[model samples]
Target: MSKGKFSSGVDLPLPVNAPGVTKQERAYQAIRDAILNGLLQASDRLPSTRVLSQRWGIARGTVESVFERLQLEGYITRKVGSGSLVSAVIPDSYLKAVTDTRTGEPDRNESVEIEETPVRQEGRYRAQVGVPFVARLASPLLIAPAEWAAHLQRAMAAMKPEQMCDVEPQGAWVLRDQIAQYLRKHRGIDCRAEQLLITNGIRHSIDLVARCVLKPGDDVCVEDPGYPAVHRIFEKAGANLLYAPIDNEGIDLHGISDSAECRLAYVTPAHQSPLGVIMSATRRLELLDWAQRQNAWIIEDDYDSEFNYQSAPLPALKSIDSMKRVVYCGSFNQALFSNLRLGYILAPPELHHRILALWHTIGRSVGVSEQLGLAEFMRGPAFLRHLRRSRQEYQTLRDIVLDTLMAEAPGRYRISGEHAGFHLILWLSPDQDEDALVREAERLGLMLQPLRNSCREIDLPPAFVLGFAALTRAQARNSARQLARLLH
Candidate 1:
């Protein structure tokens, strides 16, 4: 009497009892049940709509309707050439079946092989460099607003159709406009949106610039104890690196000019890496003049200039670049999160199209959704509010760190470069073994860096670069205590 069968293969439910259910509905329910009951598996192709229609004595349109319903319900997936397949949503009973088959133990219901993620332990003390924890922490913690999220969601939904087709090789124009406005307001670098070429991040931006400008084995001047990653990138691009030593003022232009074969120079003039020194206005003018005279390009990495603790943010090297010699690179990696991977290059107007072409050959572009979200974020009132909040936070943390060091270590450590950015360099006594101190500090639950590590060779008068931005005031105090103990 029943058409539906039970586990024992005996008929259970009478098909006549379900009078209102259409034949198409019946087919859809049967296929869905088979999928949920573990009879059909993920990736198992289903019968063609025509075959099923013929076998079940239903119209082809009706079968097509059923398959479409199944697809909408996530019971099946359709591929371009490959036919519809069973979806991978396993029912609770099917999961139980899997566990039962593997161990033959019926009572074990817990999900096996799922390991707990370990908690990130906060270090008591640290002196690591090359990261902008202070500049980041100084900025107010702005969670992306709901409107931003909504914009991203809408963009992503639209991207489904657009992605199936081709996108612009340069980048999304809307994002370029947004970035241009942001840079104009904050960095005072005047440019059209068309001149900007977006890349994966600062490193990728550097690669694009290198590809556009330099040839293999061409000599480029890099600051001594400069960004190590920059050196690697230059080498990979086939450039012979020449060292330009940095002083308290910034990269020594005299040393750079003296290099016989140095054709280009990379400098973090706004705020030097590791040293935390700002290139004075006088030196900046001199460097620009030198570059013009030498017919060389200046790669000004204006990283972390946004969180200037002492004074108003310095004008970027590109701001005064009348000769069109500066390839200005900056990023939200420090201002926002590191993984954002959105950095930009402002090449001279003449080089814009060339860099754009180079970017197209390297990678497609950043994700459409993220670009849209960032564009919306930059236009909003929240961004300005966040910037103000970050400035105060960084300043407070900097003060707390300075006070702690003065109270604890006193004359033992000479603190330098606390005027801007997220860290200060501590020059230690000559007798101290910088490497040994760092290793011992690590064992005692402190993360520190030896000044020598930043150098190509050994450095005299051991020093450490300490970052206080990621830690709270209380955390900074506690870390300072641990550092004081380590030093003593």
Candidate 2:
């Protein structure tokens, strides 16, 4: 073995005692215990074999053998130049074994629970309103692990030293490039990599933009009956919010207070949040013209556009903007599930530096390994295929729930906004009180969100946003029937 120090600078904890086992076995067991006990988390880099051998006063070959065993058993994943990293996918069997060793009882709980569903004290999984569900794509989930793992391994292997530490505040350049290309090809939004900034998610993107653009007490226009998070994000950034009601065509710009002196406008033009209305071309153009005339910035949140089932998704508002006043925000969290936390903002060329500077001031950036893995995933064919699969699955779930609703409460309720998006609006009559209805539904263990809760200035008819994407066919059917029973 060569007497040299580790090239990889990561520090890993080695066990103090190596009793009752060979040197190689001791090394493997210690590293494995650290991983299982959460001392070494997913994507945490393991030190080089040279370092491990030097630390333990063993031959480097022994450390290499231990690494090989762990890799073969799937406890660790190794790449040519990236060294080794703890695998994110921990096997249930391995977990059970570790638990048995600790407490002398094996862990038999292997059931997988969806993060979006809340577990009640009564021991039932309750699907809440505005929360995502994931029952449709089983076995090979949306982002296939085997495929993604291969790409991730490749990305890690190709990663350079400078790429790992002190990452760019705007995000990895490779991801930005991939996002720019994706926007051009899929969203019809033309932008260079220099004009894009990777964000944690839509909330983070909007917060950053608000800090950059709005001074304290500056007026900002937001869609009424919109995502409440939008209002909260702006409020935290010290902007005074103005309300603009949304119709079937999207946000009613005509209804906005003309005297509000709004400096910024936030609208979900593609499959409007909680309502599923696609913004009409005329309205989109009018909004862009308004932004230009008022010297205001339009934040176009194009979240969840990939799952559109109606027509091919309309060209984004940013695509047609001739005045360079729109900042387009998009999120993979909705499309790939909430834990992904990967989103991007396509800012105008002028605002790029300001956005980058704001991100630096925040001093928090997304994990580099995941960013690189996603960049690799987007550059391949799997991501598009995954979108197609999810769209089809969501459409089926939507149809099942819609059919159940119509069959159970034919003339009692009206449904709208079902032409696209993962959710539909269940519009109630004028006499029906939304608050009481939601409360009653909750008492019956059916989580229904009141549509009026999202409204600030506009008093609209009572309704609920029914998200069907995360539900299984049987769960959707049962839930719809239960809801229909409540109505009757």
Candidate 3:
């Protein structure tokens, strides 16, 4: 795909990403920009699709489509072997002379159409989420009941004419206030609405934090058996992710190099994912001290912390941050349903404005209807009732699974991390192979997520992450017996 004699002068610029614009749109704009700015003169040769695609890191088909579009719009012409050449006359009449909408004065290169889809998606996207709550445990109801819909209707109906055009990047103040109150009353996190920035979910919050706070090559300490998506997020953000292993105390701080100049630590202190070990009080302070000493930040993901069976869950890691090094994130997706698509970050006061600015820049906020409806709901008893209902329901499901497993499996396995969260750990005997057990479970039509699947490198004792939420009593019993047979 060499450009022959035209390779030297051909300068195809890369796409500049605009919020809500697709990569194809950006690439189109890039080529058009190259023409309008005189970087690509009339009659100048353009590179082959392969060359342009390789240079732009876009798919070759995408580059070809852009070329086709350019040709369609009278911008480029292609010959059999000479490749693409800029048209003798580029379309500049409208592009060079865009009129200002307010004053009717000639504007310089400002008007371009980029199709943007709705950023905030809300509503009962599914009847149930996570554990298939409706199908297995409760009546087949959506995450939101009829009451929620009525509230949403009222919310939308109540919007004033001017309010329809409002944009709240930090999200509606009412929702933030509700979240603040909820955190204070339920999670023991003392925070104000002013310090909160609404997000899509914890994943989105983590991504923003990494992009905003971490620079390329900055070392970030993450839990080894942690959320796989988050590991990819950090890597994508150009941060060097160091998978710090977890122990009964939580993430083994000693394993993390004290002198590596780690810029951040990501931990689920309340309920360690997959393993479900609450960070001991001593370890929490030690982690805080480590962050303070290293001048690093901590991302406390309070996922599934809402459900604790053993005792009252500890306050979030941010609850006792004397040095304000922790950025607390929580989501209603797990608390309510996965499709809620709403979460918030309690950014440290120092980082609040930065995170908020980034939030606004990305236009990642829930829609007015969802936010307003949720605000109203959280302001009432229904939200608390929902929590209570879910807690009770999960506890029932937990009991069923426990009874069935205890009866069926007996002494073949040990369970941990069952005190909180929907999943529990089934620690297999050392001689049992995790992969073999997983494959056997698959063969038996039972879902068995190996604990090793969550681990990055360091080996953990053989175990299975037995998630029982999506199972009914019968299904649970059957699966338990199947697992018992496999283990025995």
Candidate 4:
């Protein structure tokens, strides 16, 4: 029999762990004791067999055998991508008979009794926007569950105990290094790992930059009718925002005067939010030149540059920025699952330390496990393979939605923008009451958002940003038909 502590730091004494017991029996008793004593609560994840074996000074095969026995006994469950989770269903008798080894009584397990979880229904909506609909977003074919699981386990197994202790505010060095290489190959951004700071998401990245750069009441140029969330983040940072409207080419430089004199400007150059237009290369150079002349910073929010079906994605704005004034931001939220909330910011070399300092001051750090997992995911063929498959699938779905709308709506609507991105804008005649249409759609159990929701410029035309990434081809057809009937 061997003795060790549970991952949760609880100690347990079991008959199987006593002298003369076989190693397998001792392993079984240790797990059972951990479960009943609340050291491993229901739904809690168990360490991988490799991690367990290393920790216990035992063979990996023995740990695997123990896991197999636990699975057969219904003590744990395993999912393909996500590893082992403790079983929620504990035999009622075990809870009642659980022993308090310290007290030589049966009371400890009672304290950690698991509660039943309730089932809830997903909200029913039609034509949802801004939210990533999990069912419609990434296809499983692109993201192989078994492969993801294997990569995740390997990443976990590769971690040293000390590596998991505390994450750097700049993020895991390995993930940042991979991101640097990924950006160079994919987005044409020339940067090193030192310039990249890992963040919870784009919002956090923006906040960190604002904290390090903006003083209270400083002017910041933001695209009008852009990502509303970015506006909110800058507002919270105490910026006096200049709403610069965007045209078909991209952000309207004419809209901002020479005297506008802003410290920073935010632009979605890759694919403009809500409008889906790629910022032209000429305009890209102009923006960079303006930033250099004004001695200002540019925050390029490269949102959804991965799913371009029309043309090859333009090199990132930062690639053309010889002035070192661009702070490039990208998020895995839209590319991966939204809940993951992993993002990165590539700061200028001059400001990198300041941004890192601010990041550390705020104590913002992503979980080491996910960072390591993503590092491994990107290091292999998985990430790029998934990106290719998803881009192809999304283009198919986009075509379906566009075709259905054209056939059904006829003269009532026109696609204002559709060259790239997961969503596009349907421009209705200015006379059409956008609010009334939205209300009627809601009454019909379809959710529709008016263009006004994303705009700060009041005179913009009436349109609806239609998100098609989450809709299946059949759903798109049905939704279009339903809207056509309502319109007629």
Query: Hey, what RMSD does candidate 3 come out at?
Result: 24.5
Which has the better lDDT: candidate 2, or candidate 4?
A: 2
Tens-digit lDDT track of model 4 for 1-488: 11222356223343445444467656766885566555676677777878777767678898787777566434677777787877633333333333323445743212332112111111332224323222223332345667767877999999988777855657888999999988886676767786688898887888888888898898899887787778887898888999888876678777777686589999988778878776754466567767766778999988788887855455577865655678999988767665566999987656766777666766765788888888999998888888887788788877887787678777888785676777778788655777787787777766665667778864677877777676666766677677666555
Listed per candidate, the RMSD to the true structure in angstroms reads 29.2, 24.1, 24.5, 24.0
**Deviation of model 1 at 441, angstroms:** 0.9
Model 1: residues >4 Å from true position, as ranges?
1-151, 154-166, 257-259, 457-460
The lDDT, on a scale of 0 to 1, for candidate 1 is 0.66
Error of 3 at 291 (Å): 0.9
Tens digit per residue, CA lDDT, model 1, 292-348? 667677888877888887555765778656456788887876676555677788876
Best by lDDT: 2
Pairs that collide in candidate 3 are none
lDDT of 3 at 306: 71
Worst lDDT run of 10 residues, candidate 4, spans: 113-122
TM-score for each model:
0.68, 0.70, 0.70, 0.70
Colliding pairs, model 1: 134-422, 138-390, 138-394, 139-390, 140-390, 217-238
Instruction: Note the residue pairs that clash in candidate 4.
Output: none
Task: Evaluate residue 204 in candidate 1 and report its C-alpha lDDT on the 0 to 100 scale.
Answer: 79
- Candidate 3 stretches greater than 4 Å from native: 1-144
